[model samples]
Target: MGLFDRKIPFKYLLMGIIFLIVIVLVLTGIWMSYVNSSDNLRENAYRLRTMTESYIENSFQLIDAGLKLYDTAYNHDMQEAFAVVMAEYNGTGGDPSRMDLEALKTAIGGMDVYVINESCVIEYSTVPADRGLDFAVIYPDFCIYLHEIRNTSGFYPDRVVRDWSTGTLTKYSYMPTSDHHYILELGLQSEYFEGERKQPSYSVIVDEARAFNPYLEEVLLFQKQKRLIGNKTYVPTPEDHAMLDYILWENRTSQEVRDTGQERTVFWEVIDLRDPDYAADMSIFAKLTYNDALLSQELARLGVLHAFAGLLLLFFGALVVIMVSRELSRPIEQLVNDVNSVASGDLDHAIRPVSGYEFSSLAESIQVMVDRLKEQIRKCEINEKRFMDLVQFLPQGVFEADAEGNITYANRAAFDLFGYTQEDLERGMNILEALAPEDHTRAKETFMAVLQGKKTEGSEYSGVKKDGSTFPIIIYNTARMVKDGTITGS
Candidate 1:
């Protein structure tokens, strides 16, 4: 039989089936747990996004409020500074080279003021490096933005923007001269306005976000970001620039998964904080990062526990199979031993009682057959006694012999006819041995003719008596058969 079709012992079959069921359950449970772990990761990403986005949004909201409060005071201050510089310009016959730009810088909280001509070139500054710089070539977009602000008569403010050359946070303001001869500017920013701005700036808040949450790996607020942390400027990678561009172009929230030895989920958010008072784009960007190792470890631990539970179930199932198989084998073994006793001709051997009704009925049936055989044997003994008594008085010699020529039974008349005593008959004596040496072959032929139903009434052979004397005798015999049609003797 094929392996699948072969009959297995009850014990092993039961254990195999139970173990298969347990393994399937274990695998299914582990698979489901893994699926839920994926869901948990997404949920954690959302939760982290929700929790951190608020902190980011609130920081921007606070900055927006700070800008409004700072704008009113700073705008007024810039407008007045322009008027004073204009007075100085006219006072020196509009020769900016002769103006006391350093005196004006000290007069206004160490601010560095600049004078940009209509040609968009920095002509004069409190800082000597600001002189003779061409804004149109060095900062074309910023210059264009400043030119636009020059047409407006009111003070305009810009959001906190990073200084490219020095990697510093600088907020600038602009106002046009009534004569429109030059667009005035003022900023000396990194440590210049620290006392006036809001406490806990954007960089500070983002840097501290990781201290509160364990799953949070990193945080970045991209809205007018500070590449410079304290004095060090963080040079971003190409991937960082691409993500920033995607957020700016798509103007929507998005996410990405990345694996760098350790896996992480990055969530991005875009916030619009633009206002007419600002002279530049004011879109806000927030990125929240989370780790994945802890979740994987937890799921792996659950899988191990599931496998352990399956093993425990299989062990218990094996124990139950052994117990049940042993209980069933006892009755069957007893029935087999009873059948063996009957086969050995022990009709007197009793069938023992066994467990279960089926085994008990089988034992009773075997006992009945044994009892019937005993009755038949008793009847045969009685019949043999009557035959022996009848044959003892017969005038003719009567005997019984087997097919092997061994005389098995004989009467007194037969013993006298052969000149042998009952004691001699009790010993082994063949019918052929009772004949003379010359008559042995003829007597055997006549014996075969009798067994084959041939008429041998006149067939004569010389017999040898117990005293070694020879005599002529005629053999008379018939074939004997049992109930099964087997020849017993003649």
Candidate 2:
């Protein structure tokens, strides 16, 4: 009762079903590719996100251990100059009132110096105007950093940043004294900062992550100042600020997906920054954005390829079906037609040989049957000819007629007995015609009765001759039927 339940040719039905299957296969392949691509995108994004978080966390630890990755010799030289200056001004504790600031700068390789007390205020500096610069009021993030450094004896280096007041690109470093009395600050402004800024840094490392994953659109790391940096500088939007705030406030990971098929995620961790009171926490948050453009291209390409391949399958499948169906049924059709011809009484009709082992055998068997039948017919015909020759030599007359008493055959004795020439017999003759005018009615009745399956025996009657004469004759007539039910006389 389904839609395809109706009767149809086997060849066409098979072709239809196979073509439909090809179409379904093509579409399913395309759909599966999309699903797999989506899953791969999610997996790849997760790996990159996890790697970024681990790299930054480990990098910070290395940085804490005085791992100056950017420069080796230059960093050692800076440290050496800072040690000499520290010894020269050790007693002063960088007390601005006791030392001449101009002479201090010349002795320290022309580097700016800022000495801060426990209050994290710039109590003295080579630049006099920088005096009394309260870090807590001006730069709270930098102030937090200095407070952490005042408890450590290791020198800490920072990246090149433009000093807001002087608009000079400067590199800064800090060191606390043995007694934790003051935090030493060193600032250098040189052409080296410009080349170093353009060199390969951690920001480039984050951006290069995209090489490993095509779906990765960007990776952004937020500094203590809440500034986002990646390949190039990126200005933070309201959404960016809100997302960072939410992640930091929750102190956990967060993920979001955009309606435009962009997946955005932020990962955060709270690690002890090695500060006194164990009260301060350093927050490192990385934001990763995943895009679907490449996935879109791949899906489209897969669709087109599947479609083309399906079409090819259909086209070539149709050709194969046609050839196979013909090869299967053609020989049988020919055999059927030959059988029909023989059934219609054309015994001489030949059975044409066909291809295939089964068909050839069938044709040979049919041809053999026909030959045997023809041989039987020849023997029968020969026996009948001999019978007719024997009947001709007999002294008794014999003949054959239809149910209507029409003469179909006659022997020599019959022609002679009826006084009719062979021409008269061939033209037209009947039992009634052979009888006298007075016996005609009886002859007709006798012929009909004989045809009705009644037995007929020797009957006396007056037979009329073609010469207009009459004779007394005894007829032995019988009606018979043949295989096709055609009535005849004997």
Candidate 3:
């Protein structure tokens, strides 16, 4: 509310309000920019996470497809073996022993195979010790999964299972005879396809991360128990290990920032690449660092620019206010000086035309007043001269005095009657001096009474000339006033 106080000028108040508005708007823009920057960072973190997940998932799918192709190839080869065994049984009346299971197993890229009868008993196997044994007794779950796939369709779709005896995960492909009396099983360890032999290299992950996000400053890959598997860094720092430790302990997938003591801000994003097949845990982390001071560099420049602009505005605004105030007050100041001059008896000191309609009308009014004053003074002088002539030719003497009873004017007849020179009248002569000493009291009373607006008829008084001669004289007393009817003197 003080902004609107009248003691402060209107232009100054308006400039202050405008400056405050500019400051508010600039601050609001800065706040909104920060908010939007934070939001964009969060979104970028999530999108990077998604991209990494997709890359791993796609790699796993490709490996699984490769395993499925091998399974299909093995299934077809085993079906051919079952058909050969049946044909040999029909022609030679014996089990199909001529079919080399070892060579067939080697050709099918498998380590073992087992042939089982309708009762789920192994009749032939690459390892002879497994013959005459119940296959379901050895690995019932695996046999069940095999039959489930065989029952479903010609192509097998089954996942790997852990073989408790060998401490290894194993995958199997199977085929059955058309009569459904015999089945062939081909077994291979899961590691043969998904272990170090075929898994994606750590370099692939690092390369892909670098390619996807150029902002990445470094990447660290770790196995379970904090074992460092791989790392790639554009700019290595000593604090990286500490930051990674914090991220692992917190188990947070979100991005976190750290102060690197080098006038830079660094952020980290961790991804847990967990898989059931692997015996240990794995993680992927990415680090990105940037100069935090750079964030405010532009804003600092903008602030300086705003300050400069505000200074420019203030300077121009003050200049304009001064000019306008002077323009408005000029005419009034001129009129005041002219009035002072006229009061000092310089009637010719007249007003000139002032700029603007209002000031022009005021100047015209003042000129009219001055003209009327001059005219009245002219008439007063004329009346005084005519009265003086009449008094000079009269038979009696005439004189005038101020309210204080000091003689101000005397006509020629008054001087002649009193026998005083004109010099004596100019030297402040009073009529009381011309009266005889004994008649002074009565004459003084008469003069005072008349000056106070009382009329007096002629009174006989003894008068004395400057030569000390006394004579009998009659005096008439009266009062006079100037124009406008204000009493001046008698």
Candidate 4:
């Protein structure tokens, strides 16, 4: 008749369905949270890697351009100083042996110079070791300079040579006197390229790396790092040296991206400075590590928000289920109790209506049935009273028993005969109890026979009173059949 009229509670079923929905939502939230975090991390890693490489390239380019300017300026100044020394030599009778070469060398800033007589022989010299040697014998390739000075009587371009054994760069230049009597030779080392000029140091490069890229954590500069050869050896070959130079050049030009790490990434590249100016050429490795602190913080906040949302979903889902289940079941439960009240013969009891369309309709139907039953019961009571008045005045006692041998109605004369009060009969006193103990089984059989429509005549049996006194009595039973002809009682 009602949703929960049987033993199982419908609210538990509703709660179970809600629990499954909550579990699915929680799992989906967790999955989406991890995916969001991982995607953010990957994107941040890529962005920072590109930023770091660009900063390194820009910084190195600035330093390289500055050094080249210094180199070009120094070369022009040195050629002018050589021209001055040659003009002064032509005034000394075209003989450097008679000239003030020491004063001339000191006045020109203590540079190395030599004088070659017309015989192509080293004569007066600032460097004592080169004083008496034949120029053609020491430098067999001096024929070109000799031919130029002898025929054209002009100066020669500066030649740069790296003395690898001594780790010094020597610049050689030859100039003829005005009278064409001598050739002046000059040599300057790599230091003379800028004459104590300032250059960007490793520390400066490290600072520049950080200055340009704010996300940089630290810069690691490995100077003169040897090339890796096989597994156990670190011997640097020409090819290895050349490869490092190429890598450095490619990095500065193209800016290759490197491997990335979590939270922070380390990027490294070789910086080559193998040009002729250096006494000893070597490469440096610049390792830049970058950190995106803001991105990391954002991911942390995302995690917290994900957790909070999941918890809120669970709490609100449970509350809604509880409220909804109670709302749905409350009216049905009230209808069941009202129906039970009518079943217990409380025909006059009022049936209270409940909420909702279906529940309200069920309550209305129950009330209509109760009102019809009350009318029927009123008519039955009037007929029963008339019957009882005739039976009450008669000498024979009358009673009615149900199918289970429980007395439903006992007339006044029947109650007086059985020594049972009206209250005792109203308390559902069993009619079988009025019979003698030995007659109980026979009485039960007789009741069954009447319910099955097998017997109609009354029988004589020994009846017992409440005081334990026995007497002979005749009991009659007839099936109490409903509209469907089903026997409900006898």
Candidate 5:
């Protein structure tokens, strides 16, 4: 058989299909994982944004409440009453003694009020004098209000002031008293709105003074934002920045620029604490920042772990594919090589089975086929030798012919008897050509009768050689056949 006739085993084909299926499954799983992760990221971002918005809104409400309180206390009637009291005390040429001061303190205590004279001197305060000794110096803009009051009669300024104290932004409303040449500054405590609740990390009050001189000593002079106790700016680290940015980008509203060149945008909305019509709003930006920082750290850790696991899985999958292909292909490759060797005429070679049951069965079948082929070849050799020996004894130019009357085999005696050489017999010389013209007719008749299966008695015939020699021959003809039983003429 030709080399092209070799067949591949079923196992190899099955293993290839399995390997393909595994690869497709692995790829599909990875794709699904990627899609899930992306969805999780989007969901996390949206949640963070909502949280930040709520926090910002709460902060805005707190500030708004403080401003409304200042407005309530700075009414025109209150300012006129305070001016009349100051005029009575000044006109009497009275020394504002401790008893008088104590009574004045009692009157203003409920409103958390402070009084400054035309000279920018703080004459009375609800708190002790020492506690507010340099109050005018610390807030020079309050002195300006006193000057404006002294210059104008029955005038009330709609302006307010911000005092940054102990890292807290306090708001105060000022009312001008031209009759007494004084300005009444009403101050509120940070805890007044919330009623002693825990305050936020930072608070910024927007008032008229702050609007004019936005640069406060605590906000501008301190390079660092220290944790309430000292002046220090909070310098975020790289990781902190990443977390903050993630949260802000995810949560905060778009940027908005004001006429003052400042970007003070509302990041969130909540109930307005100062307005009874709306709910309290507060900014928990610091809390949101901390959450974002934590999330960023966790996400980074998860990413690293995912990358490591993916690499490990990739290595494991590759190893599995390689090992499986090698284990399965090795035996099949060997079988193919063995079949090629057999087809190339190496019948003596034996096929060795490997470990698999299928390979073992295939090897046994091939061995049986080889053994049968070898036995058949040996029998053919023996028959050919026997035929040659028999032909050696033939006389009267005896030769084998097929049903077509074409000579199949011619021995040396037959050649000598017919005066023909080996070349003439090998060239398939016609039986008619081998006979003389007179004997050709008789030779044809005898061959025709033999082809019909009739036994022919001894007949005389003339045979010719390659050298044109002719000789008389006597033929005792009978039917012959191939070893397989097909008929031949003789």
Candidate 6:
């Protein structure tokens, strides 16, 4: 009753609402986690795509430049000049002196040359021993092309294979001649083509030697090849080669060939750049990884917040339930205490009203009933004392009888006259029983006459007491009547 009784039900209703809200929050949190994970994966994919596109574009640029440089070096004017130098060296029986070698080297040096040939045989080079090397034995295809140009007089401006005796990647551009074909093979180190930027993970530049062989073996041997070319000598490192072997096989199917040379195909792969184990050092991948890490952190933080909020709500709900339950039970507790007091004969005790209107009304009603019961008990005490005083004043023996001939009341005079107390005048004895046998019949006739509203005057009666003594008396009898003319007693 009070605010507590009315609002306690609402509190339970609110608790049910809060429970539903918490369920919704949990569902939303799960959905958000899924969305965040999907977004992270999508961002990683985007980063990988961007990195791959950049790598491919850069590769195309490098290939175009290299091809253009090859074409420039194989022009007609350059071929004619190389052919003139080759005819002179062959006319001299292939024995080029130091002065002749220097002049030939100077002529090819105009094109930033590394090697020069006379009569399809190397006669001069930036490195001294490169002269007097047979080009046909080192590169049969170039030699065959030179022989074809000598016969048909056509210019060959295509990529050709050449021996890398100098232990470097060499760019060879040939000019054929009739007498002594001059072959200019420029040793362009891989470093020159690599530019300022470093290669990304899973990208490789393969030239002729790598293209002819299986890519799986080449990728496996990449470190070994790098060391061999960098040091300009072969020094086998088995552990390094073994380490490269596992990933090399994994790359065979994933990689795409960018360019094909005479003996090699440059292969590269567009792997997930955001993979931390592989692309940890890349800036783009690092940023993507950071984004995913941030999302994870956010999800964890939200979970903690949700848990804290739920705990707080639960605590508040428990507190509210305790307060509301106590408030609702207070009135019932008061009612029980009041009833116990009344049962123990403490009728003076009264119920104290609390907040509820119903409790107040019940308390008032209980007090009223207790007051009426006390008044009735006081009136009964007064009547009993008055009756005892009246008995002391009566001189004649008087006995009261009900209409059924049972003695109902006996005064002190009557008790002394009959040698009996009021206790002996109970239902077991009547006036007729107290009379002597001879007077019993006369007593009944006179009593009946009086009961029938006829007064009996000077009736003679003899009675006996409980002590076995007998006496004679003259009795006057009359009928007792209520105001409504009904006989009450005789």
Local distance difference test values of all predictions, in order = 0.70, 0.69, 0.62, 0.67, 0.55, 0.53
Q: For every model shown, what is its TM-score relative to the native structure?
A: 0.61, 0.54, 0.45, 0.52, 0.45, 0.35
Query: Model 5 reaches what TM-score against the true structure?
Result: 0.45
- Please provide, for model 3 over 266-356, each residue's C-alpha lDDT reduced to its tens digit, 9 standing for 90 to 100: 5564555444432223345545454444444544655566566656655665566567666666777787788889889999887888888
Better of 1 and 2 by TM-score: 1
**Full ranking by TM-score:** 1, 2, 4, 3, 5, 6
Model 5 C-alpha lDDT per residue in residues 431-454, reported as the tens digit of each score: 777778998778888888887778
| Candidate 6: segments with Cα more than 4 A from true spot | 1-10, 13-21, 32-77, 89-103, 106-171, 175-490
| CA shift of 199, model 6, Å | 17
The number of the candidate with the highest TM-score is 1
Give the per-residue lDDT digits (tens) of candidate 1, residues 88-178: 7778766677888889888877667888888888888776776888867765656777777676676665656555555455667666666
- Two-way lDDT contest, 1 vs 5, winner: 1
**In candidate 6, which residue pairs clash?**
119-180, 119-181, 120-181, 208-263, 208-264, 211-264, 211-265
Model 2 lDDT tens row, 89-154: 676765545756567678878988888878878898887888888878766656777777777787
Residue pairs with clashing backbones, model 4? none
How good is model 6 by TM-score? 0.35
Model 3 Cα displacement at 13 (Å)?
A: 17
Clash count, predicted structure 2: 0
Residues forming the 10-long window of minimal summed lDDT in candidate 3: 274-283
Q: Considering summed lDDT, which 10 consecutive residues are worst modelled in model 1?
A: 224-233
Model 1 collision count: 0
Candidate number with the higher lDDT (3 or 6) = 3
Q: Residue pairs in steric clash, candidate 3?
A: none
